[model samples]
Target: MALFATMSMTAGVSPATAGPEQWKIMPLGDSITHGDGSSTQSSYRADLWRILYPTHPGLDFVGSQQSGQLPDTDHEGHGGWMIDDLRAKTIGWIVAFQPRTILLHIGTNDMDRGPEPEQAPQRLGALLDDIEKAVPGTQVFVATLVPSKKAAVQERIDRFNAAVPGVVAGRAHVSLVRMDGLDPDLDLRDDLHPNDRGYGKMASLWGAALGG
Candidate 1:
């Protein structure tokens, strides 16, 4: 599950098919994924929807709340949420949305302000485990955390990202999507979330990840 290996293998796995409810896709994570730092309060999920669904016209974003662009206002991103919190709720979410795909970009808030940042990856693994167990055929795109400028914070982020590949190892339909290279000082609206241009870059990165 190394990034290079995952990148190579992820290709040619065509996107999930649209069904009666469209191919439900859930963007799952914390405030950064929730678009907290953005002026419009819509994260990359909004931009990602704009870029992919317009041409594909097959997938539908789904979640418990709506907070993004029109026609794309669905995701499971909760501000200030932690990995353990997400793990606890993922099963119920899968039951509710029945998503074929999950775009996961979490761990930032945990790294920044966790009681134990070092344990974030293990928690992430558990979350993915829950998802795979609950939804056997679902695909998961696991993103490396975007950088935090502070050295101490960024170091933890790196460690969490390093452990991500192993977290997904031998797991069905789970792949790592690179995000650490998306620099936080430049891309972030403040200390955490992506700005408008950053969101666009994120959407483009997701496109590259999905080969869209």
Candidate 2:
């Protein structure tokens, strides 16, 4: 599926800085953000930071991630955190950070757990609602969950991606970023996590989405 409409950054804000007015971009997700299966500096999130730092020149990007954390950022995304775990763990952290923009990549683990195939949308919707409540003015970039080469996992990812747009519907501050067709080669030795090249592509796509 295609991406959703473009959403504006939060208003009345200058570029981020080290001070109070600084815009903080938080990468909230599971192992992807943690750079699993790759070296720490080579992880996509780190690569993204390298790309974004000089480009933005004002924004202060911070990462709050734990390897195998659930709900991705809030709890633990690894080991298949369903929507329920997301609601419980991630909401508070987003609120506490009060970031201007949030880069959210989640729901992959949920597919692994084998929840009712049809329930992905509802769960994602609920997660969106919780995020809105927790951070009223935060600009949310909802990434289309990346595809795994594994047939069963990829099928579930497809269904989850389809459901993401509906969850963020009518939210002017939310946008769906399509990462589906960007990397077809897989480039992953594990057939799950991305290798350095794949991570570079992922970071590049996100940089494009952010207009970096």
Candidate 3:
């Protein structure tokens, strides 16, 4: 990842030029990261831009491609992507971008279409290991799956989420973000994706996890 992200114009102002961009933040996931529920294209990313940059100066969002209506149009969100898909591409992108940090929320597709529902967390662990291999010191914040409506889906989600902490524990440059209580009816745009308000909530959770 590039050291400095090309900052987008926000609140009618360009990025500060005090120095090169210090932090590169990548929102890597499935459709949720693709901004399916939010009209502003990843309400979490949009809201993160609106809220975080003021306090966390010189932070730039980086990715292989850009999306969203915001001036900073970069991310690695894909619709219906499974952990395997992410596993294949993640390291390459990490090497290309050399990001300082990555915000990862994946495995939803695996819950919906399981090759083996039990292996999701292991795949996640492998992905994290790949990141450490590719980027060495990059930080990763992995989110547990948010709430879902169906009983079976939620059960699978719980199983996958339950395994996440153990996989992340004792791991360098990786941590878990709990999403067990995030409401589906309240935040979800559909059975899966988060609505604008939901994405805002997601953004708040992510921001809080990032810890300035």
Candidate 4:
């Protein structure tokens, strides 16, 4: 993986020299990031922006996501995507955008389509490697997969979350944001997606992780 020392920004500005008013944040992940089962601009991404921007006043949270898509910024996040698909499409966009920070919410797709539970760690590690290679010094915040009400899928999600910390352990720049108890009720409309209240909770969790 490639590594670059933190590049200096002008007066707290980012590499793109995006002004305080223009600072951009790219949300990269599966449907959760795409705000599945919700209207555009009403998803968690927007909620997170609203929660954080007031205090920061320099960041612009931009959505490069789509429903039922993978990692490609222009495409929608498909309901189920594996680690390979994530690495293949998302890495390129992260490199291109070079956002100050990346808010990631993946692995649900991996859990849904399984038989390769053991490979989750390796795949997640490679995805991290690709992110570090593409944009050295970028802060990669790995969010633990949210809980699903479905017994089988929820169990798989639990296992995936359990595996993530170890995969990212000892990496100075990577931090894990635990979402375990954010909503114990699993308040999702379906076993797969969250409702408005759930999205609010998710946004709050992200805000706390980001120091909002």
Candidate 5:
């Protein structure tokens, strides 16, 4: 529950000097954020940019890590990372990037490789607490994980996703965006990752959440 994020902030580009019209958005999550199943590996970030950039010309995606082939490839999407991993680094990334908006889609790994699925919601809440404390004004959008094909994994996913709204409740800047209607048999490329079409669907949902 540290209020201020303590980090050097020296490694990346200098602190953002965004103009009044510009908005820096950070996509913070796992491989889905990294564009794992997409052919272009741009993930939903690229498609999201395409959706929002025309109207919101200054919509900038910022992060330490880089992937994809798009012009704005920056993001904080780490593959195989859990909610706690993101929690540990959230403050540092916030301090470095100074994003005004954060898109968080996490906890898939915890559900996939865990003995305890019930605790993910609490961990997610803790991460949100840190984010709210680090920068209270920042707009946060929390999305439920996309569907999975495997019955056992999907069951855990269903339970975890079901608790997300409750986790995000009462956080003034945080909003819940449900990723429903994505068929695992059709949308997913692998067990858990989304294909290009699925990423497009995700981008559409994120775009709607951002009011684009």
Candidate 6:
């Protein structure tokens, strides 16, 4: 059967009970994570909630900042924020919520306006380092960026994506989610943001990672 079908089968085994106050899952990133282009403004978090909630009834999305239409709307996504910007906030957020899992997709904003876009991976590494220091046991999922329409930006994204595995190599609590398969012409609502369908695809990947 299909993956989601399997998820459905598994999900029915439990009743929804756990909430954001109990499970503390942080969705950390920029505009995409904030659901900027989606019609419902639900983002992947909504769909990811659909996929994981039934099985993880106690799962809670936690962050200081909240957006999207999800029941657990808490998240750390900021519009136009870059890796370094997030790095500055990560330690404090982790300390506050003490999340059980962290979904991280950042760095695209760095390509838009930064002194050195090429340094994104290094900056991502630093963010991960901060995350590790804050909460050693929390599971962290880092995603490669979805495709951008602009060729110049895509080039920087490609280089940054290529270096992600290296940044995640030694970290046992972290895993890489390759989000580069999105078709910019079809998946993007604008130059940088994913449309609803694209966000759904992202949610599927995240669900698969977490389910594993």
The candidate scoring highest on TM-score is: 5
State the lDDT at 181 in candidate 3.
Answer: 72
Taking all chains together, the TM-score of candidate 4 against the true structure is 0.79
Clashes of each: 0, 10, 4, 9, 0, 1
**True-structure RMSD for candidate 6:** 8.6
Minimum summed lDDT over a 10-residue window in model 1 is located at: 12-21
Error of 2 at 209 (Å): 1.2
lDDT of 5: 0.90
On residues 141-192, what C-alpha lDDT tens digit does candidate 3 reach at each position? 9998887787789889988888889999988989888866778778888888
Looking at model 5, residue 131 earns an lDDT score of 89
lDDT of 1 by residue, 1-212 (tens): 57755765677332362243367789899887777777777888777877777566777888987786657788899989988988888899989899988899988889998988988888888888888888898899999888877789888988998898889888888998888777676787776677887888888888778767
* TM-score (C-alpha) between model 6 and the true structure: 0.88
The TM-score of candidate 2 is: 0.77
lDDT against the true structure, per candidate, is 0.82, 0.67, 0.84, 0.70, 0.90, 0.87
TM-scores for all candidates: the values are 0.86, 0.77, 0.88, 0.79, 0.89, 0.88
Root-mean-square deviation of candidate 3: 6.6
Is candidate 3 or 4 superior in TM-score?
A: 3
Q: Tell me the tens digit of each residue's lDDT in model 6 across 161-210.
A: 89999999998799999999998988899999999999999999999988
Q: If the candidates were sorted by their TM-score against the true structure, best first, what order would they fall in?
A: 5, 3, 6, 1, 4, 2
Per-residue lDDT tens digits of candidate 5, residues 70-168? 879999999999999999999999988999999999988998996577899999999999988988788899999899888888899999998999998
Ranked by TM-score, the better of candidates 2 and 3 is 3
Model 2 clashing residue pairs (backbone): 16-23, 16-58, 17-22, 69-76, 69-77, 70-75, 70-76, 70-77, 71-76, 74-90
Clashing pairs in 6: 18-58
